[model samples]
Target chain A: MGDEFCSCDILHENLIEIVKKKMPQEEKLYDLAELFKVFGDTTRVKIISALFEAELCVCDIAVLLGMSQSAISHQLRVLRQARLVKHRKEGKVVFYSLDDEHIKTIFNQGLEHILEPRGFEHAVF
Target chain B: MGDEFCSCDILHENLIEIVKKKMPQEEKLYDLAELFKVFGDTTRVKIISALFEAELCVCDIAVLLGMSQSAISHQLRVLRQARLVKHRKEGKVVFYSLDDEHIKTIFNQGLEHILEPRGFEHAVF
Candidate 1:
């Protein structure tokens, strides 16, 4: 989208102009990449999946996932720092859950695609 | 769910039961992570964002992103491998676009969370 004088034009100019105007800025792209990076781990995804159904404390997550408490806590801290999960204190215990609808939406939508992709399933393979 | 008798119980048993029931299997979790890892790169995220707006060929993408054609092709290959994008040939030229609605949904939803977080934005810092 730099200018009208660049050489490549595989798409319609109007469409290219529109896309250039709407495309995310570099910083936003970086943040977006960073956000996905948090989700790009098996342990973290599992944690988010577990929290999708209900809130759970660190100990509970460890037990459910069959991981050590310290390891679970480390991943939770990453999720917490990324604002993917929220925690509330109940006495000495802190429980965690999906931060908001966005996490669930991302998880559920991605899953929907993985499990059921109308016609594109063939292209994926 | 592993069993009915694990020690930690910060949440209701019924809720734990449900999350365990719904949680993705290990293979799916690994796949999910792999899918996201592809998104975790800034150049790749920018590529997807550009595609989100309109389909374009490698030369156009390289020009638009101020990157080399080889670099753009490399990321396009990665995106192709992850099934995040699709391509078609028109004689000597090939074009690419977001594979399906899943990518669009994932990108839009994540953007929404980042731009407007219903008062939870503060926790992200």
Candidate 2:
């Protein structure tokens, strides 16, 4: 696994170098920017947080969050498009959860940092 | 530490409820959205990566990244404004590094998840 990660670092290094030479054209930067922009919103973050605990239908999420169904639906749509969350339908209700377990690592780790009193004394060397 | 995180979760629950009851006004979401927006860009991601390892000034970064001095400077300014990076002046050059080691925890953790083979096989319990 460490070996594979080493290869991935090499790839990332090559890619970063390529990006530097190209002067960061707006189109690519815009796409990348859009992805990061998704992370910027607190509403979406809250929605993801709620989803982290259980697979919830939009209405349940709305109730749990005290948000309107319409508002929750809109944010969920954005998350869906970004591949951040996926949903399954059962009868009239749709249940939403994280698209992948890997993503939860990001959210959970971020939350840990934000919520911790002292930051990150626990990294594996 | 775990207890504090548990308390943080309670706080998050209360906050989420308040946000939900309010119907998610655009004003609040916008601020949240803007922060997510910043994370969306690839160039910014690259800049963050370069700084992750060591402190480098604009010129060295420009060389290492193959990006223009102006472009790197601009992105650095944005990162600074976001409190993601801090710079120190030494003679004619300014050296920049990750603002707090806490952030590298985020970046390193994210990259590890992204670049690893199966993703997050080693998360601490």
Maximum-DockQ candidate: 1
Tell the DockQ for candidate 2: 0.18
* Cα lDDT of model 1 by residue, B1-125, tens digit: 44333445644566667778888798888888888888889999998999887789887787778787778889999998778888999876789988867888888877877676445544435
- What would the per-residue lDDT of candidate 1 be over residues A1-83, giving only the tens digit for each residue? 44334445644566667777898778888888998999889899999988887889887888778788888899999998778
- Each model's lDDT comes to 0.80, 0.61
Ten residues in a row with the worst lDDT in model 2 chain B?
A: B1-10
Deviation of model 1 at A54, angstroms: 1.4
Off by over 4 Å in 1: A1-18, A117-125, B1-18, B117-125
TM-score of 2: 0.59
CA error at residue A63 for candidate 2, angstroms: 4.1
Q: List residue ranges in candidate 2 displaced over 4 A.
A: A1-35, A63-68, A115-125, B1-37, B62-71, B108-125
In order of appearance, the predictions have TM-scores of: 0.82, 0.59
Estimate, for each residue in A1-125, the C-alpha lDDT of model 2 and write its tens digit.
22122232343455446545644344544454555556667778777766766666676666665567778789888877666777888777677888765566555445444444532322225
lDDT of model 2 at position A125: 59
Candidate 2 at B106: error in angstroms?
3.0
